[model samples]
Target chain A: MKLRDFVLRRIILAIPVIFGVLTITWFLSYVVGDPLAMYVTERTPDAAIPGIIRARGLDAPLVVQYFLYLTALFQGDWGVSTTTGADQPVLTVLARLFPATIELSIVAMSIAIVLGIPLGIISATRKDKAADHVTRVFALIGVSMPIFWFGLMLKYVLFYQLSVWDLPHLPGGDRYNFRAFGSWQPTTGFLLIDSLLFEHNPALFLDAVVHLIMPAFCLGYITLAIITRMMRSSMLEVIKEDYITLAKSKGLSERVVIYKHALRNALIPTVTVIGLAFGGLITGAVLTETIFNWPGLGRWATNSILNSDIAAINGFTLLVAFIFVIANFIVDMIYGVLDPRIRFG
Target chain B: MSDELVLHVKDLYVNFYTYEGIVKALDGVEMFLRRGDTMGVVGETGCGKSVTAKSILRLIEAPGRLDDGQILFFDQDFETKETIELDLAKLELEEMLEIRGNRISIVFQDPATYPNPVFRIGDQIAEVIELHQNLAMDVLYMKIAKLELTLSEATSDENRAEIEGKISYYRQQLDDPPEPDKKSMREAAKLKAIEMLRLVRMPAPEQVVNQYPHELSGGMRQRALIAMSLACNPSILICDEATTALDVTVQAQVLLLLNQLKAEIGTSIIVITHDMGVVAETCNWVNVMYAGTTVESCATEEIFAKPLHPYTAGLLIAVPKLHEVKDRLPQIRGTVPNLITPPTGCRFHPRCDYATSVCKEKKPLLEELEPGHWVACHHPLRS
Candidate 1:
């Protein structure tokens, strides 16, 4: 029942999950005919094809190739991208792009959490009032709107029309001011932090923040809506509990009864949603990144998939799967903190 | 000691507005308690016992309003050196907060629901202590700031060290307070909470204080709840079905504890329960309720000895006795009437076997038949 042992057990359980994800991605990407299909074309150099296939280890048996993939994966060799033809390792490419998605997801999740929980509490406390109705309408619109369309509309409004109306041209689509920081000076990988700390450019940091707002809002709106609705309903249910009555009977302030007593228990479900949503944000970054021209893993993965870049696709799936498992593990730990009933064995 | 009135409720009415109808939960219910006396509000389910208790505290939230009532709480006003009557129903929230946990406290039905599960028992008890306990120099920082400003404005260098020393003393008390002083106020509060636990006979109060509510058994939880409620040394403690959720053995133990507490702390108690046995054993006075109205009020022995109200007689007969021989236990006919459209006249007329034309046409008010006994009935039992 110890917390450390519980955590260790969860980590052990995640191994099989990671392996399953990697195996599925490997079989789907590698087993389908040629790994070098994207590199091949109807050219006159037919004799060089066998040499290229042998060079890429496509000549090995299926089982041997699986073991080789696992070994190379353990050794941090994620194979090479076939689309660029520059022999760039998938690991290095993904490493370069992953932080942009992480930064975006962090900002987006922060916005969701900051706005969602209090709004939900307000909606619950003022149930059936004007405040509740307004929040419900806002949540409905936020949930129903398509993210892609929402992103484009945001760009059109804030970046285009708003800029024309005498505002500074808001940064959009790009990660940072590429002109100022020309070389990809890898520091912390997170552009916001790297721009400030590594690049030593406050302008770049401010510019990155400006560019981040629109896409972050577009991505975060759905999570905010879902969290708000969840919190409202959960708070409503928890507030009706006898514990809440007992809390008020103790003459504790209404704030303490609602937040300290009801909200802590209500938030158990919200934590689960937040964790799952964070993982979804990572995968969902593909569409957001494409619209915003963010050079993150999602955009890279989409490009790789279109080009049949097998190695890049495999690495991306495994990485996302690992992050998902870790997020769920963290949520479980938070549940233990929130409710004393859920003791781990 | 018993003659000193602690709480007096007159014509208290509580109504719950629901989609179905407005439930007149407590319709003109009246009761009074004296110092160190335990008064039991005995009634069947849906008889407004809990409602009456909640109304006294003005804890009836939205959709359920304290429609009309006067809860006159008598307490000593320290500054005035006289007992003051507080109309709890009219008191604003700020004033209510001062009286709620300090002068009056409550022990709820289910012990499991009383303590917040996330916090340790020590923290829960300590919170109440910290809320009620006001230490001298507790109005910290602002006074210190004003003193610092005065020290700064002073042009003389001669008295600078003395002023500086005074500032440092206040600062030390603000930061790491010394023992037996304003600085160690929180520690003192925690110690008081633990002392309360010890008073409730919680074994190894030191270890139990650190554990969460889930770590304790049902009996322990109830004991902890009692401990938490008594931490402020409240003048009146309301036990709203305090022992109903526990097993029989634990129930007896808890009742014994409450009796011991009443003797030791001299706190008047309002025991709201449906259990007649609990009333017979623990209560000094019994008030029988039916459909949100008190049908009978008398001393426990007097009510049992010469039951005047037909409803009270029915309740006494319904209780299964060990010495009596019967194939099947006697039970009262029919269920509790719908309070929203409650029976006209006497609410119990429909279920009363001795219901007369007078009983059906007119409601009998609670009237004193003897010196210490009161009953609401048209057909009074003659001895």
Candidate 2:
């Protein structure tokens, strides 16, 4: 099949996946009771409850409500937040919070990929040497250590301990000093980008980056470890392949043989992990965000879940599922490119 | 075939350190390849045939170390016209790179897995040419075009002198062009790659050049591999079970192609295989390896007619003859010994029918028993 056709088929196939996710989310939310329950108090009138249910299409039959939900979703109306933002559109709330998560996730993912892949390659190439053993231990710690604990530890050592020792201590939590940038307006909602691009404040960008380091590292460490392990094993397998021997026999430099010939094939599996891990990073940022006090979707989702905000919960689940679907679609496309054996029909 | 020795491997030893034990993969493997001979190193599975081949290129990876040996390559320095004797085993990996693909190339078994699955067939072939030849493809193209144009426009005898001057100038440029642009280098390599594909008799060279390894048939992939190996016209070409992975028909075709290419390219070919028939068909000289050691080395006809070592005799008897009918095709007694702690003396002693107290107690050195026939057996069958 042509590349275009293959891509189109993949995109078309994603529709059902997203639809399935949305349906599941809707069903799960239905089981959780009325979303407007929190609004009802001892002073609340029984008459107001019916108006709220009717206005939100909650009084309709289950099937009818589902159809209405689907139609409204297609029309870009994700319903109003019931508890968290109170009367605000779910989409708007999600959109406002989405960029922060995206920006943090992007930074976290960059750290994972940049460090993970090379570390893995080094470990594999060195095999059982000191370098290999060191990375292996590092990866072990990264994988086994709880994210919350790691974040807390990082804050203790880098923030708390540094302050105690009278060293240049990093900010413990939160994203930038709001007191200094109170007058600053966010153009992109990504402080780092907005600070530099629209605000033209290099000092603001620096501060944003400074606050970003600990949280991003804390979030990315697990994925980096996973990627490093994946890359190492993949590279080890690829390097042992007959093609690698052939490449070496061709009198190509070691760099060419390893990087050009072997690395591409090895990166195939690593790319898969990276793509999936990216989606995980976005959704799994809850602990990191909560610990660091970063205002992102994960923190917002936490409050929404605690408040039993079904609409907001559904919106978050659907968005995450969509991200996963998109990530997998991209991974599949990359597989086709990396491995010629994969023919999309 | 030239009498000059192209490569001589002496007392080669390779050991693989595994969790179980150290696998003495290649122990004292000794062989020689003359300038233009298709020598076959035949042995059964796990006899270290591939290890010997890899040792020649110093391509042994970690865990498998070249324990001890001298791979003396009589490399001809083109500019000086002097033969440089370099020990392959002694040289560092970086130093070996110049000779690995340029002076010696190997085509491995499993052609499907050997050529990188991701790269185009043409690019893989072109990459080798670009590395060794160091010619700017774009500049080379321009020079060739100019020369062809000059030759085509040579209609008058009066201006022949001027045309000759232009032709020589273009030829000089073709011989030594300036450093090429990356894009032009690729283009040049692609053109050379097409030429190589044609040389290997790959059908529809133009289309095949653009296709990936998976797009080609088994025979075609092997052919493409051969083309890649022979791209730089290395002095020695090693085929490590090159045709063993193919079906009977394609095997014959590839073997035929190897023989034909050997003659055309003037490369000293080393065919590593376990099949005796392949030895009889393509090789002039056969080096029979038995359990990481050369049990016998002689002319192919001599070894077949007058087998020396008992192991060699057993191997010959094992081949199913067409005319002779038997209840069970003659089989060797014991399985190949584990190299980790191989039998005390000779590795094949336990498996040999002619085993005695001395055979078990002592390792036998390869001795020239007769004219041009070497055997490492304590007891030689006097048939």
The top-ranked prediction according to TM-score is 2
For model 2, residues A77-118, the per-residue Cα lDDT tens digits are 897786554578999898888988888898999999999999
Q: Per-prediction interface RMSD?
A: 1.4, 0.9
The DockQ value obtained for model 1 is: 0.57
Regions of candidate 2 where Cα sits further than 4 Å from its true position:
A84-86, A343-345, B136-138, B142-176
**Alpha-carbon shift of residue A164 in model 2 (angstroms):** 4.2
Candidate 2 DockQ, CA atoms = 0.73
The stretch of ten residues in a row with the least summed lDDT in candidate 2 chain B is B135-144
Residue A93 lDDT (model 2): 90
The residue-level lDDT of candidate 1 at A92 comes to 81
Instruction: In angstroms, give how far residue A3 of model 2 lies from its true place.
Output: 2.2
Which pairs clash inside model 2?
none
> TM-score per model for chain B alone?
0.86, 0.92
User: In model 2, what is the error at residue A225, expressed in angstroms?
Assistant: 1.4
Model 1: what TM-score for its first chain? 0.95
